[model samples]
Target: MKRPYKKTDLPVWQVRKFLEPGPIVLVSSHWQGKNNIMAMGWHTVLEFSPSLLGCMITSANHSFDMVRKSGECVINIPTADMIDTIIAIGNSHGPRVNKFTRFGLTPEPAATVKAPLIRECYANIECRLADRRLVDKYNFFIFEVLKAQAATYPAYPKTVHYRGEGVFMVSGKNIAMPEKFRKGNL
Candidate 1:
């Protein structure tokens, strides 16, 4: 058996460092002939059915208004190899530069949404605004996925997860424990 672990006090705001769900995603938006991409890490899967995703995009961010006005965006999942591009998009201002052109990312026309998809990314999820009840208070947007596509060769992409304070964790080896799960659970 493993030894018991010690616990330490942590600030409330810093709790996200330990509880951030899933990997960072590139949110692409287009409105009034302008396109923008923003790197987002504060997102969570809200439901399996209807494929709901909840993310917080501060009003100060340039892409927030674009996404809000358009009512749609593409959530692109980049591999660990695109860390530089991800950081560049996050650091740069959307109004000043075109991220797709600046970063050399291909923008493919999406099927359901007006926002273009990032072709270089491992996967892309086209989403439509589903709820705005929390946006006014929390800057949170709830999206309903309209379509999703991904590469088939690699079963899992090397995704990057943020741990706050400029720290990131890359996806490592995956373990399949199908036997440990009940039917329809895996």
Candidate 2:
């Protein structure tokens, strides 16, 4: 048996590579009669009650202006089957490419907001801006989830995660923890 082990310092630029595995979500925004969709990978769960979440959208993105003005958006979670479409959607600019038309995606009207939900995605979360304190400095928007919908086959639904630089990975295997969560006092 032969084993090879090596250790080397990772480049500063590659630090993002370690944080790249977060779930990828398609953010759709509509304002002043214009709508756009952008794929993003950097987001985090901020709270449990009211479902607070935070996501970063660069000021350069086409959806940024719309979302900032509207103060609402939909976060659509795509399954592994839509990996190619997800990549295509993220690779092209929204202004030039009508993602719905170019990527063959279906847009369904959302209940609480103008942002359309991608019908092809396995899950959709409607969110409204909860705080705008970090937008100018970090392009981060804090959202309070309004509603959520998910497919029945949530166990191992093969969702994709970004690995940086045109790389992606699909979700696999499900595990259940034994401990039960304690309810927090509101």
Candidate 3:
């Protein structure tokens, strides 16, 4: 029999911490020809065919307005070396500051979207908004990946992952399962 659900004895935050870490993506959006970027830790892959979905931005963020209006964004995955730049952009308000200019970051034109990609980042995933209702109440934006580009960093293949408020961890090691398990045999 299944055990009863109990909240009184469990630490909910600890349970959330158990999830597999994902990359720290810098989501760029353009509005009225002006561009902006903000670091986001809440993003995921939700589809394969035509590629789609999942990004979360607080309702109060300025980037939220830009993204909603433009319907396009570029997700740039930075490296471990970009921690300082990521923290700076994540902590500041775009309305009051031009992060790209202030941080000495370079922006490269994206092929399919108005939003530009951060040149220093390791990877760029250009996307168009697939759904905005996701952001209406949950602060999440679902998008369809239109294009992707990666820097020539063969040594460090993965992107950075934000641990919490100010802590971040890099992709450390890789482990592959046996072919039997890979095919659901084990």
Leading candidate by lDDT:
1
**lDDT for each of the candidates?**
0.93, 0.86, 0.82
Tens digits of per-residue lDDT, candidate 1, 71-116, equal 9999999999999999999999998998889999999999999899
lDDT of 2 by residue, 1-186 (tens): 678879698888877767775688999888887667888898999999879999999998888888999999999998878878877777777778678888888889999999999999988999999999999999999999999999888655777887777778777876665465555532
TM-score of 1: 0.96
lDDT of 3 by residue, 1-186 (tens): 999977566466654344635687788888997889898887777877869969888978889999988989899888777788888898899889888899998889999999999888878899999888767889888999989988765756656776664566778786766764755444
Indicate which candidate wins on TM-score. Answer: 1
Candidate 3 at 60: error in angstroms? Answer: 0.9
**Clash number for every model?**
0, 0, 0
Candidate 3 whole-model C-alpha lDDT, 0 to 1:
0.82
Candidate 1 wrong stretches, greater than 4 Å: none
Q: Decide which is better by TM-score, 1 or 3.
A: 1
Q: Give the clashing pairs for model 2.
A: none
Q: Give me the displacement of residue 53 in model 1, in angstroms.
A: 0.9
My TM-score estimates for the predictions, one after another, are 0.96, 0.89, 0.86
Rank the candidate models, highest TM-score first.
1, 2, 3
User: Against the true structure, what is every candidate's RMSD?
Assistant: 1.1, 3.3, 4.3
